[model samples]
Target: MKKRICVLAMLSLCWGVTDATAAGPDLDGYVEFGGRLFDVDGDEAKFNEYRDIDNGVYGNVDILSYWEGGYYIDFLAENIAYDDQAYWLNGGRFGSLKYLLYYDEIIHNITEDALTPYDGIGSDTLVGTGETEPALWNSFDYKKEREKYGGDVEYAFENGYFVQFGASNMESSGVMPYGGTSSAEFPAPIDWEENQFNITGGYRAKKLTASLTGQFINFDNEDDSLTRDDTIGSLPPDNDVAKVLGKMVWRPEYYGSVVALNAGYSKTESDEQLGIVVPGETRNFDGEITKWHVNGSWKFEPIEDLDLKLLARYDDRDNDSTVLTTLDGNENENYSSEIFKTGIEADYKLSRNNRIDGGYHYLNKDYEGRSDSDGADDNLFFIQARNYSLEDVELRAKYSFLTRSGDYTVEPGETDEGYRSYDVADQDRNQVELEGGYYGVEDLGLDLEFTWFNADYDDTEVGLVELDHYDLYFSGTWAIQSNVNTGFYVGFERDYSEDLGDAAETTYYTYAAGLNIEAYFMAEKLRLYAGWDWAESDGKSEFDSADIIDTDEVEDFTQHILSLKGTYFIDEAWSVTLGYVYEEWDYSDDQWNNYVIVVPGSRGDTFLSGAYDDQDYEGHTGYLSVKYKF
Candidate 1:
C-alpha cells in the first residue's frame, strides 16, 4: 500500500522530532521506552510474516547521540512485535570531516498457512481448475518486504592515503513461496529494484598496502513474467553488473617477508530481454556473462620456528552469448569455465610445546556444460598436530585427503531422472578433525569437537553414491569468583547419502543443542539470565515412479527455545529489564499431506495436494525495558 504510506511518513517525521525523548534527554544521548507482550499458538507459527503469534504493544529503543558540534545519531531496534522485524537508522559526522545517513526496514513472514486454489491472490494472472477439480481452497501468507536507502563517505590522508565512496537504493516486494511449476509449486509475484555504485582507493605504508576498486550494479523488474496458477512462464531479466578490482600487500621486511596480490574483472548483461520472442529466436535468453580472476600469495620464514607458505590461483569464465535460435533450425550452445589452483603450507616447532602442520593442494577444472556440472579434477592433502604441553590440557589433530577425477556429459534426452552428476565423479575423499580445550579453572573452560567425513562414488557410472559425515561437539564454562557465571552446550550431526537414479533418493540430517546461564548479585546491582535451545530436522525420500508404485516422502522439523532475564539498577544512569520468551515448532510433511481441495491430474500424488503445510507453532514473549546513559 504505497509502501505502507512511505513508511508512515518516515515514522511520523521521526517520531515528531524524537517525541522529546518521552520527557528526558536534555542534550547528552539517552532515551528508552518499552512495553511488550505476545502469546502464540500452532499453525504456521508466524513463519516470519511478522505477527509472530498475535502479539501486542512493543516499544523499546537504543540510541546513540551527540547532537551538537561533532554531530551524531543512531537508533537500533529488534523484534518489535511480529513480522520478524529489525530496524536501524543512522546519522553521522565525527572528527576529520565525515558523513553518513542510513535507513533500513525488514519484514518477512514466509508461511502462516499456505493453501491455494488460485483466486487471483495479488493479481497478475491466476486461475485454477485442472482435473479432479473441487475448487475453493484459500489460505495464504507468504510475504516479503525490504526497503533501504544508503550513503557513505571516507577521506583520510596525511600521506597514509585513503578514499572511499558509496551509494545504494533497494526495494523489494514479494509473495514468492517457491513459485510454481516443476509440478505445481505455488505463490509467486514480486516487484523489484536495486541500484549500487562503489569506489575505493587506498595506500598505506609501513611495508606497503594498496587497493583499487570500482563497481556498478543494477537490476529492475517490476513484474515481467510468471503465470502458473494455471500456466505461463519466463521471468528474471533486467540485469546489469560491472566490476573492476585490485589489491596488493607487500612487506619488504619489517620482521620478515610477505606478499599478496589479488585481481578481478566482471560483466553481466541485460539491456532489454524479458521474454516473448517467437520466430527463429535471436533472444529468449542469451544473457551474457564474463569473468576474470587472479590471486597470489607468498609468506616466508624459511627457518626460525620453521614456517613457510606459498599459493596461487587463477579462474576464468565466459559466455558472451549470442546464438539462440529455434524455429526449425535449432542453434544454442555457448559455454566456458576454467580454474587452476596451487598451494603449499608448512609450520614446524617441535619444541615449546610441540607443533606440526602441512598442506598440499591442487585443483584444475575445465568445462563446457551438460552432464551436471561437466568434469572435475582435484588433489588435496593435509596434516596437523599440536600439543600444549598439557598443563591446562590442549591437544589437536587433523587429517584430510581428497581425489576426484571426472568424466560426465549427459545431454540427449537427459535421463536418469534428469541427472545432476555435477563435477562428474571418480571420487574418494576422507577427513578427520579434532580440537581441544581445557583451561583448568581460573574462570573455567572446556571444549571439544570431532568430525569425520567420507565420500566414495560407489563405482561411479554416473552420479551420486555413498557419502557420510559425522560431528560431535561439547562445551563448558564456569566462574564463581566475581559474582557468577555458567554455560553448557552440546551438538551432534550426521548425514548419509546414496544414489541410484531419479524421481527420489534423498536423505537429510541436522541436530542442535544449547544452554546458557548468567548471574550477578546485589553488589553488582542484580542480574540473572537463562537460555535453552534445541533443534531438529529430518528428511527421507524414496519415490521411483513411472505412474505410481513405490513411495516414501517425509520431511520434519522440531524446535524449542526458552529465554529469561532480569536486571535492576535504577541508578548510575538507570537500568531496568525483564524479559521472557518461549517458542516451539513441530512440523511434518509428506509433501504437504492432504488438506483437501483436489487438483491432481497430470500424474499421481501431485505433491499429495500440493505442498505448503509448514505448520505447528507456539509462542510467548514478555518484556519491560529501560536503559540509559547520557
Candidate 2:
C-alpha cells in the first residue's frame, strides 16, 4: 500500500517535531496506544510465524529532541499496524552533519497447510490437474514477504575530513517451496528486487586513519522461470555488483608502532539468454565473477608487559564466465579460488594479575576448475590465559588446534569411491574454552561457561567420519534491595555426527537445553517485569549394516516462553502499561511428521503437503498501553 503511505508520512514528520515553533524541539517523548489479543491452539500459522500477532490495533512512538545549537532529534516507531513494522529517523548536528531514515517490515509465515494441484499458485504459470487427490488439492500458503528502505548522510570537516552517502531498497514477493521433475513440488514465485549504493571518504588523525569506499549492487528476479506443464525451471537471474574499498591506519608516537591496511574489490555480472545448449550453438550464459581481498596488520610494544601482532591475508576469486563447446567435447564450466593467510600474535604480563595470549596461523588454498579437490592447507594454534588475581574473581582459559590438508582428486564421473569431500577433507580440529567471573557477592553476580569441540576425518574412506561438540553455561545476578532484581540463565548443548554411506553407517545425535529467568520490581510508582523461557531440542539417527533400519527420533522440539509487564506512574509524565505474552511450541519429525496426506501411498512418489502436520502451537498475547512524557 505504497509502503503504508510512506509510513504514514514519516509519522507525520515525527509528529511535527513537537510543534515546530516558538523554540520547540525540546521534547523527551513517549506515546503509545494498544490493543491485542490472541489465543492460538495449533498452527495459527505457527503462532504468527514471523509476526503479525493477530487481533490487533497497536501503536508506539518514541521521540528524543534537542535544539539549542547542537540540534538533534531521534524518533522511533514500531508495530503500528502489524507484519512486524518498523521505522526510525535520526537527525543531525553535533559535530557537523548527520542524518538517517529507515523502514523495515517482514513476514515469512510458511505453511498454511499447503496443498496445490496448482492453478497458478502465485502466478508465473502453474496449472496442474492430474490431481491424484490431496483432498482435491488447491490451497496454498508457503509465504514470503520483505521490504526495506534506507537513507543516510554524513558530512564533517574540522580538518579531520569526512564525507559519506548511502542508498538502499529491497523488495520481495510471496510463494516458496519448489522442486520438480516427475515427483513434483511447486509454489515458487517470488519476485525479488534489490538495489544498493554507497560512497565514503574519510580521514581522521591522532596518528592516522584513512578510508575510501564505493559500492553498487542490483538484483532483479521477476519470476525468471516457472512454467509447469512441460516443466520449465530456472529462477534467480539478473545480477550486478561492483565494489572497491580501501582503509589504512597508522600510529607512530616515536617508537610505539601500529599499522593496518585493508583492501577490497568485487565484481559480478549476469546476463540472460539461456536457451539452446549445444545444437547449432550460438552461445549464451555470459556470467562473470571477480573478487579480491587483502589485509595487513602490525602492532608493537617491544617490552614491558609485552604486546605484539603481525598478520597478513590475501584472497582472490575469478571465473570470467563464458565458455561453450560440445558435440562430444565438453565445456561450459568455470571455477577459481585462492586464499592465503599468515599470522603471529602475543601478549604477556606475568604479574600484577597475570595474563598471557598466543597465536600462530597459516592457511593456503588454490584451485581452478575445481571438481572436489585441487589444493588446501591450513594450520592453527592458540593459547590464552587470564586471571584477575582474585579480589573479585575473574578467570579465563582457551585452547585451540586445527589442521587440514587436501589434494584428493576424483573427477571423471565424480564422487563415489572413497568420496572425501568435506570441503577438501583430511581434517583434525580441537578446541576448548572456559570462563568464570564473580563479583564478590555484594549485589551478587556470577557467570561460568565451558565449551569443547572436536572433529576428525581419519583419512576418509567415504565421507565425514567424526565430529563432536559440547557447551555449558551458567549465570546469576541479584540485587535484592534498592528496588529488587533477579536474573538466571542456564544452557547446555551437544552434537555428534559420523557418516560413511554406501549402504548405511550413519550416526547422528543432537541435544540442547536452555532456561532463562528475569525479574525486576520497584515500588514508588509501581513497576514490575518478569520473564521466563525454556527450550529443548533433540535429534537422533542411527544405522548400521544389513540393510538399514535404526531410526526414530529424527528431530524433536520444544519451546516455551512467558512474559509479563506492568507499569504505573500516573504522575511523573503519566504512564500505564499492562502486557502479557505466552508461547509454547512442540514439534516432532521422523521425516516431516510421518505422512498421510489423504493417504494414496502416503506420499511415496512425492506430491504431499500436509504442512508438516501443522506444527504444534499455543500462544496468548495481551496488551494495553498509554504513555506520555516530556
Best by TM-score: 2
- Candidate 1 has an lDDT of 0.70
For every candidate, C-alpha RMSD to the true structure in Å: 28.9, 29.2
TM-score of 2: 0.31
Which parts of model 1 have CA positions greater than 4 angstroms off?
A: 1-27, 30-38, 42-48, 51-98, 101-105, 113-141, 145-149, 153-166, 169-193, 196-217, 220-232, 239-572, 575-596, 601-620
* lDDT per residue as tens, model 1, 1-630: 543554454455446547656544334445566677776665543544444434455554556554556655556555443344444555545644454545566766666556666666655566764434434566666677777767677776768788888887888787765433355556667778889999988888879889898999998877656655335555566888999999999998643789999999999987444333342222355478899999898888877887788999998998877766655787756778888899999988989998999889998888774435565788999999999998999989999998887755644235552465635566888999999999986889989999999888634543576688888888988886667788888887877666653444667677888888888788888898999999887877665666644434456678989999999976778888899989888877674665544454545435333334546778777888787866
Clashing pairs counted in every model? 10, 0
In model 2, pairs of residues that clash are none
For all candidates in order, the CA lDDT equals 0.70, 0.79
Q: In candidate 2, what residue range of length 10 has the lowest lDDT sum?
A: 275-284
lDDT of 1 at 578: 90
Error of 1 at 383 (Å): 86
Writing each residue's lDDT as its tens digit, candidate 2 over 375-478 gives 88989999999999989989999999989888766732345545446877878899999999999979989899999998886567676777888788787877
